[model samples]
Target: MNEHPFAEFIKILGKGKKGSRPLTQDEAYRAMTMIMNDQVEPIQLGAFMMLMRVKEETPEELAGFVAAARESFHHDTQTISADLDWSSYAGKRRHLPWFLLASLLLAENGIRVFMHGAEGHTEGRIYTRNVLAILGINAATSIDQAARQLQENNFSYLSLEHICPKLYDMINLRPMMGLRSPVHTLVRLLNPFDAAYSIQGIFHPSYRQVHQKAALLLQQPHMAVLKGEGGETERNPDMDCLVQSVHYDELSEENWPAIFERRHIKPEELNPQQLAQLWRGEFSDEYAEATVIGTAAIALKLLGKADNQQQAEALAQSYWNARDKERFST
Candidate 1:
């Protein structure tokens, strides 16, 4: 029998914190492969999950973890390459972002949107399914169904479990243990069609790049990785967000990962009734701002933010500013 890290991993978990060791990015990657593939037993698996959650992962550590996750899907380079402007995220939280609205808005303007997520993994407000219903869109569309939706509506919601069972299984373990695991690093970065351009958001600031590298490993045409608010110390809601936009050609460059760092965002605070009215096409002051901001982002990326970065960036900001006043306000 091979003397695998599986036993040691179990020891780390079951032994209850004698002193946890930080594995190198490479080592973490290997351990992830073992556990994800079931080469490790359940007890050890649970132990490793707890220790990692407590420690809080580092950039390199998470990078490797996400790699193992994508591999577990036995995901092919082909599926990931099916489209551009591919955007994915973890399950929706208390506030369902206008992501679906962003999707519909983008699609209506000719951008193909592909989104994938899981249900009941996170304990929070249900957003994806309910919001889609509000839009007259069926949330449970099959991959084919979703693909059709994308073709017709330019928006599709895919179940991560259907696309990649093991990866989905990994994230589900989080709520189960009452701890958020490193697996989330995998979920936010999943690019089922391996899109050339992707926009992803992560709750934990530390693991944002895990999403970025996951994109690099596949050599995307362009990608953006962002960190959203909602860890401990909720008061400091990540004002704007940290965005890294990269190009396939620049992947090997020193600053291949260009930083669109720490944008100061005063995201509007809209109540449910206000939000509902906005969705129903009632148009609110904030909805206009939201749409312009969203549109400018997609437009800026399409125009190659690297070369004419400043002008493109300003255009993006102006978009939201103008809309905040009139975009949706009826």
Candidate 2:
């Protein structure tokens, strides 16, 4: 039957280590397009997923996958626009997602932030959409709804469940496959709305460069990837962070020193309610506040709201101090 269109993809990936190599960017784009369109056979899909998982994805492969995903979602430049595209797929295990507050701080200051993530793909961590609901923001069910929410609140969390069900299915395959597929990396790089700036957090430090390099290949004007706290883009106050970026078509790197000398121990229990409480000013935690400020400062700097690291932190603190405390409580 015409030699099964997708069989060659499996062959390219499944070939022995010596015989196989990374897919060209164009090849990656084509392969991912077929996957997203649900045109591959189940057997072929499984083989492809495992092969990619074992070897990991290269920057060119990742960029191509992102292009394919962006195409599948029809991320029109005319209709979809934001100041920052934030991806939060790695759920938090050691901390309450202070990154959420960082995003809010940016949104409060008139920066439109588009946040997207998937949930329940892995266990033992709290996902952003869940905490968002607890904090009184509903996850957007469609791109149209996400756009409206962004217009109203300057921030919107669009769940991958709704944004790309096909990708969600692949993420969910974690249980059946016993490992994560390239879908994980590809989803984070999607930036489906074509925002001018994009921020990403990776759990593994090694992938930091991979994400940054892929953004360069994608022609992203502004982007930053960091080994964030709990892999959620929240800066860790106790340790220095290295940020990789693509600034206006140029690649750069910067290191931000830790804010605290003493490391704060993660609480044995993570409470979602604390997120709203912290936002309402009814609760105070030194580490969490620094996390929010540090994270927001990076974003502000990337958005050109501040010229330098010191300026960004100062501006972020001002934004934090001026936030409407009761906004999330009600």
lDDT of 1 by residue, 1-330 (tens): 776667765444345466556666677788888877778878777777777777776655666776676776644555332344434435434343555544454455555667776667767644455555554567644556665676675667777777777777877876678877777655665566566566665666555565556566555567666553232101122244345555774532111122333433444443434444554546564433343344345435543542453565465555433333232333
Candidate 1 displacement at residue 303 in angstroms? 6.6
- TM-scores for the candidates: 0.71, 0.97
Best by TM-score: 2
Give lDDT tens digits, candidate 2, residues 1-330. Answer: 479888877778878978788888999999989998889988888999899888889999999998888887754557866889999998998889999999998898899999999988888989999999998888898889999888988999998888788898889999898888899888888887889899999888999999999999999899999998877887898999999999877889999999999899888899989888988888899999999999999998888888999999999999999999978866
- For every model shown, the clashing-pair count is 7, 0
User: Which pairs clash in model 2?
Assistant: none
lDDT of 1: 0.56
Candidate 1 differs from the real structure by a C-alpha RMSD in angstroms, to one decimal, of 6.1
